[model samples]
Target: MSRYSKGISLLENLLFFWCGLSLILSIGGDNLVIPSWLQVAGRMHPLMLHFPIVLLLLAIALLWMKEESWRGFGKNLLLIGANFTGITVVAGLLLASEDYEGDALAWHKWLGVVSLGFSVFIYFFLDQVANLFRLAGSGLAVLILLTGHFGANLTHGEDFLFGPLMPKEDKMIALEEAEVFRDLVQPIFESKCIACHKEGKIKGELRMDHLEGLQKGGKSGPFILAGNLDESLLIQRIHLPMENEEHMPPKNKLQLTEEEIEILRLWVMSGASFEQKVMELPQEEPLFQLASNKFTTEKTYSFAAADEDEVKELNNFFRKVKPIFPGSPALEVAYFGASTFDASSLSDLKNIKEQVVKINLNRMPLENVDLSFLSDFQNLEEAQLNFTGLKSGQLEGLSKIQSLKSLAVSGNPFGEEGLENLKKLTQLKRLFIWQSGISESGREELKKALSTVQIDFGFDDKGIIYPLNSPKIDFDKVMFQGTTEVKITHPISSVEIRYTLDGTEPDSINSPVYKEAISLTKTSQIRAKAFAKGWIGSEETKTLLFREGMKPKSYKLTDEPHKSYKAKGATTLFDGVKGKANHTSGEWLGYTDSPLEIEIFLEKDQKPKAVELSLLLHEGAYIFPPETVEIWTGNAGTWSKVTIPPTPQSTKTEEIRYGLLAFDLPQGSFDQVKIKLKPIGKLPSWHQGAGSKGWVFVDEIVLN
Candidate 1:
């Protein structure tokens, strides 16, 4: 070959080799990383990509002409097109190696590879295969358009083109119209979780686009467990520390806010129902407030942030100053440790008066003279003076705080006349006057004046008619082998106890009055209620009496009771005495993290009709009713489950009451009766301490 021809052939061979390498790298470049300097060249792929489009189209146009000269020039143009295609594909591969993956990346990758391969084929064989070269050129042109479209999508977002043209909807929704799952919860997943967990992009094999997908769960397990938040992997991952490997969004992506996390936890705790509405939740519930805040558009404040140094100086041991939310300029100043509070504490906050939005002086010893200092805080949105010594006229200067939304002066000496000063605060939404001198008539008049405000005068217990307390049973032993005398007593001297032997409730007019101890002959449910001359009747109290079963001779427990609530011994379970309202009274036995198993050895084999177990359910104390209870009649080796009572629904924190779980026994009796009480493995999601283990308290167990 001639020297000039050899040089041209060598360049062609090198170009073909470069195109092959680019194709290989593009296919497997998802896990690769390039050096920092190469990343700059990688970023230039967008600019370099245009060269192949222009050159390839020009070559195709030249090939389309019928002249011999155009055909000759087209072959040379194809060589140039091949060179630019190699450069574009290689640059795209470099960019792909920088941690990009998804449907857009996949489509762009394979198309660029195909275009490069076809360009190299035409560059070498255009003269030998002219018809095939024309077909490849047309195919290359189509690939170029598709490759560019997907590349644009990867650079910008999927909706970049259509996003601006789409009609924008209001971000906030009315609470009454908002759906709990679809409207409130799903939006959070779309923003923070759907990027990696949507269809075609399941990072952990978890897809969150549809309700069915979330219900089915991922590789690890189900994302949610309805009322159980602790068992839900979705909640566990979100609560993980940011530095932990399992944290959601992987630390590199956007993290869920505290409010968002709380909302998700609450929604999952609330049975994760897709059909429930925001208004369906209790008005006093925290979830209701969170939902209201989310759906209601808040007004923007134009006030500038307080100086950092001034805010720092204002904070002391007695007074604390902080932002209402992270990165927000609005400030909340509260006084603590009443002994350290004085008139001078108010002066420290004067520098940041304009920035302060909330002030709490609860339980402080401020006098009426100190009320003047609050006049400067014109931007205050909430103020609490509960239990303060401020009198009627002292609050006149507070009327200047026009932005106040809530004011609490409960337990103060401020009387009915003091409410007139609050009339000037037109923006006030709530006012509290519990334990103050404000009468019911005065509260009604104030409510009429401030029509929009919710005035709370506390629970009404006034007038000659007082509410009666539930009657108490005076007898210590409720269950006896033979007939026993039962007596009921009332706290007030004027009150009388009405009695009934059947399971029906007692009323004042028909039920017979109890003058002394009443004898019981058999198993009976005795119900009683207190009646007073000028008072509302108390709630009915009932107790079951078993007259035929003897006390157990010996007993054993599978799980030891918690030390704090352990009674004398396992015999405590059979003790005839009932526990008090307080679970911590040492009368009840508490079990945590495990179920309570008690095996009682009866004195002799006697036919027992039923078994009753008394329990306490106090959600605030993290005490929940037993999830399940099983009773067995046979001895250790031949024991059989006689019955399992249905588990009660978990109660909310607002309910603090006591109840009994009764299980019906079989007709036959045995020497031993085994009881198994299983506590909730983890507190329900609605609980504030939701993922922790719960407690079960039992005071007495009776067999009849």
Candidate 2:
């Protein structure tokens, strides 16, 4: 029933102050573009204080408004604020842990603890404080007022505590003139800014590729503002050096020269604002992506920077350093720039690992380079030093690389003698010593010492000249009989070929020499490669195979009455055949459908001729006179078929027909003759597979 007495005016004032402070905090958070370091200090300090302040206020309000009848809720509120005060203290410590040198910060933070204690004490003794409410509330009000004043002074100077703080109107860069940003500004950044500050691919998310990116910086905020160089963070940073935390671009990254720093300051004072138009640097391919395209060029590392001034400066230095082209499979790196090397420049090379395969130390300060540096490049496979001061001692170092495959020391004075130590590089293949200090006699000595290595200075008339030319061989061809043995003959002799008649080149150590009389079946070819010394002859010959003098190993007669079954209804035998089937030329008959297929065994190579082919004919049929006995070479068509002229053969020549004769198309092993026995009349009715008797008897075929 009794409200704590006195001071309604003071309580209303404190409530209004709290309301005002909250409103400014919310609004300022959105519109204010403050220095990043200052803003971080501002936000972090307030955030650390807020929970305790709000909770304590709520706890106080619990007592001011809550009745004792409401029991423990007021006490609970006070306890919650007390627990959170510890958290507030921890956060406050962290915020102050960074660059808070002044004691004002210390005083302000301790005073906050004092106010929190007062709030807690009042909460614990609710009845007594409630009875003296107005007096206690006045003390609380004074505490709050002092805390706010102190915080405001820390952030915006003492005058800021008096009223709503308004900023001076900022003159921003004209929207239309951003392009001026590139020429007047970006070049300065590229030349002196990006090495450590702008490259995002480092410890921080920093990049200096654009104005917008610079505006939204990493680890730091927008470094400049329009027309206020003195107020710009960028200007402030440039004023710092190696020891300062806010140093422009770190000092290890070449600091901006004094004159360059002055340009940046002037640019900032000229509204530090970017023109709407800016010249964008040509988009260079990313070093990593570019190096990955070719097999030999590899990008090992890219140290990207964020500060525009540093990055721009770094680009100049980067362009001068020789790009090392690296290789894969062989995994080597080649330093191809012949520019003079200095200690500092060579020091950069120490960063490159030993995977370097080649280096062009031509026209460089090779004399100053420690030869011991070469020892680390264990995988150096090739090197070229056309013009340099490398001498005998250096050659000794170079010779120690075991993986060296090709080397050229032309135009360098690597001593007056040949590289005696070079014999250690047994894997070396091509060596060029045209302009090195090695004399002709010395080179000859090296050749004798390393005979297998192909050393070249170009063609020499009297010296041991390597014959780059190799002779070509032609394996003529092969043909064989019934079995799968194909006869192959290469016109070029002494050159051995490992051939597989199965169509693969011969690689077996025991590729048999093609012998004569091979039996074969099915379509096949003999593929061979004539190889001699280092000259690998191309596939020298391919032989077209044919089944010749083959006894039927298997067959299913498609026509009836098989023996001496002279073909009938023949438009003309061998009509579409490419060549005229001359009856005078000896040839054998090839079958379309058969009851028996010939499977013969022969020496699986070359060909066999002079076979006596005997057939048992019925001899009781329409006469078959000495028909045209033709020979077919089995060309694409029957181009070469010879005929047999009848002589005074015994009985069956003119009398009864169908009698067997020991016959042959006498020829070489490469020949395939298809004999045709055309019917004198429609075949006699005894034809076998054709369900007719129109055929004569044929059996006991002996191919000798």
Candidate 3:
């Protein structure tokens, strides 16, 4: 209390008071129920979560000024600080649990756990259970500095810690004996990052267990920026202001100590890199199995290896990435599917044409492999090989195909000077040149070359989207039944109606033109697609010939009971029914109660007769059964299932609005019509719980 008393300026008093108030109100331990409005705020990225952590660490440090500073007051302050920290941890945990991937976030998690641990220990000390406040406080600051620094690296990359240093400041340390990424970076990360970013609960989806895993990036994308640490997301996150929510290690988790911060900042600024100077990847022997085999099977498309070792590396990398995409259980299918990887003609790709989607072989070995194989997997999306031996010369082989969307050749010796080959690919979407041998001049040259194509190649999130002119239609729906001839209209001139009768996409040849005399009773969903080719159709001016004459086909009642009954049939499970007014018996159903289900079967006697459907009942007798009815005629039916609704809720049932369904009939009498109810949960009724037990009854009926 003395320490607090000494700092008690009006402002300090308010701070402590506010802290105490927060602690007290938050305990509200009385309610067993969690608050419904509970929400924690932070930018979605891991950088945002770091803010509170930095402040919390600093607040905790303030609790250890001196022994005479506050007597037992230090203990109380520590307890309050712990409470705030605990809340922050819980919130952070919640945020961390969201879906994300890549290994960069692995470091962020470790930093958090260390911070959480410090807070937990600090809690014990506050209760007079531990005699190490000074030691613990100092330890907390150090842990914070460590965790915060690493977490930032995982988000911003290596440059964040060590900014660019001139030749004067970089003192080359003696080279070590042996160098292994797992042995080096992994330890620093494990020691500083493994806490929260570990497998089970990584805050930003960053994990640093092994080498290939490093190839997998954080949520923002790859972490290494290939070979250039200066441009990596891992470093940028660390340098952020402590108050900025985007600060790494997350402000809520911990703060970077000045010493640790300085060390890292210097490291990154000096062109942070890890080099044991071992033998370069051999250009001759196959380090990666680039050949496609029957064994490679991962749905992300296909996995290519730079060599046999690279195959194993990709196998591991894919395994790590698989967890990132959930609900896509089929991803493992790649492992079970044919392995399209072989050592011969590494780029033969006869085996992976349509199968592989993502291929990762960063920094692997391979010089000449025809990239022509990339064309086969029209679905090929992501290709990464940073720091690999492949140069821009090989990229030209890939540029021919328009489907290759995301390509990263960063950190490689590939100079953009030879990027002319890429200009032909109008579909080139995301291209990465970070840390590559691509000079500023080369980059500019490549851009100048691609000035004609619509390419989103910038590093920032900003996207330049140019809307192209294309053909379009302006209609909500198309009617296939009664419409013997539909006037297919489009805003674009010289458009054609290429429709498919087999429910396939409409194209020019597979489907005949909708000439002036078009006829369709055989097609259920006849697509009166208006197409001009170059653009997607618009709705306002486009028209699909709708045959409103197409109505619900009254089903033939099975056996019909055939004879007309003297009284109307009605049941009481849900809605109640009265007498049938129209020629059909559809008025005999009561649609109420849960399950909100209603089934109707229709039987007809005549062959080749088309009929429309309708339901009727006495004004006050039957209503609401069809508030929302889902009617389905199994496959082969001429029409799509539909929802039928009643006019309104009231005692008046006679003036019942009609629920009509229409579509071309099969030119023959049908025996049964089955209508199924669904999706809408149990319907609620004021009658069952009200004065008069309201009831709606129904009966299957067909109209001709």
Best by TM-score: 1
Error of 1 at 99 (Å): 14
lDDT of 2 by residue, 1-704 (tens): 23422333344344334334433433343344445575455446566677766766666666676567443565565566655554454344434433342445555666665665566566556677667875775686577667767656555443457655656543222222224455456766766665333321221445555666677655655556777766567787778657886576776666777656755665565455565332122224231121122111111222221232331232232222212210112222233344533435444444443434565555555665666666676766677765666665566776667766787766666544436665544668777766565667777777887888888755445654232222222322222344554444444566555565564556536565444534556334555555556544543454434323443222233234332223321211222111111110112222213322232333435254443332222222222322323334443333454455552222332222223343444465533334443333222222211111122223223334
- For lDDT, the strongest prediction is 1
lDDT of each: 0.76, 0.46, 0.44
Runs in model 1 with CA error above 4 Å? 1-183, 186-193, 196-412, 416-453, 458-496, 501-503, 519-526, 530-578, 586-610, 618-628, 643-658, 662-664, 667-671, 678-696
**TM-score of every model versus the real structure:** 0.43, 0.21, 0.21
60-157, model 3: which lDDT tens digit per residue?
Answer: 65565556555455555555455545445444444443432344444455455556556655655554734666676677777767666765564455
Q: How many pairs of residues collide in model 3? A: 124
Error of 2 at 305 (Å): 56
How many residue pairs clash in all the candidates, one count each?
A: 0, 103, 124
Worst 10 residues of 2 by lDDT: 577-586
Q: Give the Cα-based TM-score of candidate 3 against the true structure.
A: 0.21
Query: On residues 1-704, what C-alpha lDDT tens digit does candidate 1 reach at each position?
Result: 99967866876887877677786686566556678888888778888888878888898889878898997787677777777788778887887765466688888888888888877777777777776766777887888888887777665546655678999955535445677888778989988987666543566777777778798998899889998988999889998988999899689888898888999999888888888988789978887767765553222346888887687777767877876532347788889997867777687787888888889989998775558778898888899989988786777777777788789888887677776875665678888878888777877777888898887878866555667999987654655657788889887877888989876789999998989998887667788999987788998887766553456777899888876568765777777776766664557888886789998777765566778787777776667888777888885558877856487757587445565667788876577889988887766656654555577888777777
Candidate 3: where are CA atoms >4 Å away? 1-64, 67-73, 102-104, 126-131, 164-704
**Candidate 2 TM-score to native:** 0.21
